[model samples]
Target: MTHGGGGALYLLLILILVSIPVTLIWLFHGQGNARKRRAIGFSQIAIFAIAIILFFSGVSYLQNIGFVAGFIVLIAMLITPVVFKNRV
Candidate 1:
């Protein structure tokens, strides 16, 4: 059971890390459409933000919760703009 839990925690960490680049691309590319892109960006941000909050709070709710998930979410938030930056 403990091993399964550890594996879950690790998988979650990897998912979070992968989400970083995906979310950033989603936000940036979504911007081209303005209304559509902005909405997509906002939703992506909200999802990541909530994920981060939940990840941290999960530490109290469940032992062995990984912090890497939250860190990756944070990185996604930071990279969103760079990926979305206007290009000529």
Candidate 2:
């Protein structure tokens, strides 16, 4: 892939799309407790930060795609808390 604006956008889109499902699974089905949730959340934030960097670095790096996917997954991760919070 080329390191141009279009490629960067493509990578971003792909990453966000992929992350959604993974986030949902982790949020809903992962084992552990609140601590685990906190850990996962922090880890995901770190991962996302890295991904953003990678996404911008170039268009061909594996992390570009991975990070985008992770971001998508993170949306789900973020939502779960709000969803449950309203109920509880």
Candidate 3:
């Protein structure tokens, strides 16, 4: 049940789809403190970059846990503030 190259493509698409709107909202909506917003943005980008690096660095888990599961967790991290805005 492995998607191989196609799984990577799907993960990239999901990141793009989720990132665009989230970035726009963060950039335009003044959702929180400027520093926190930027922090979250940088963290998301860093996580994504790490995932990419791991995938290309011959990491075996990339084919199994890197794409779908990783991206979903990444997306969740990206939007966690919004999901629990009142608490944060």
Candidate 4:
């Protein structure tokens, strides 16, 4: 089986779209714990990078669906600290 280059582009676009909001929250969460938020954000970015790589290489069974799942997880991760406020 083979995948097309378009798949990688789509995944990268989606990744950017999903990351923008999370980045804004990360930037503007004035009361948030800097160290905690930074760590969480970094880890999620790393996961996203891996997801994109796996999708691009066509070696993982997850395919584009993995990126979708990653986006959902990123959204959830972003929301958690916002809701918790002081604890984050």
Per-model TM against the reference: 0.48, 0.42, 0.60, 0.58
lDDT of 1 by residue, 1-88 (tens): 2554566667556766666666556655544566665665677667666655665563555332334545555566566666655631
lDDT on C-alpha atoms for all candidate structures: 0.58, 0.59, 0.62, 0.64
**Could you give candidate 3's per-residue lDDT for residues 1-88 as a string of tens digits?**
3455665677677776777577556644655566666676666667666665665555567644555555765676567657645432
Q: Pick the candidate with the highest TM-score.
A: 3
How would you encode candidate 2's per-residue C-alpha lDDT over 1-88 as one tens digit per residue? 3456455566556656666565556555555565556566667767776766665564566655755565565565557555544332
Best by lDDT: 4
lDDT of 3 at 29: 64
Total clashes, candidate 3?
0
TM-score, cand. 2:
0.42
Which segments of model 3 are wrong by more than 4 Å? Answer: 1-8, 62-65, 84-88
Off by over 4 Å in 1: 1-3, 30-32, 58-88
Tell me the lDDT of candidate 4.
0.64
Model 4, range 1-88, lDDT digits (tens) per residue?
2466456556557657866576657645646678777777666667767765665565556665665666666666556556656777
Report RMSD (Å) for each prediction in the order shown.
7.4, 7.6, 3.5, 4.2
- State the weakest 10-residue window (summed lDDT) of model 1: 58-67
Better of 2 and 4 by TM-score: 4
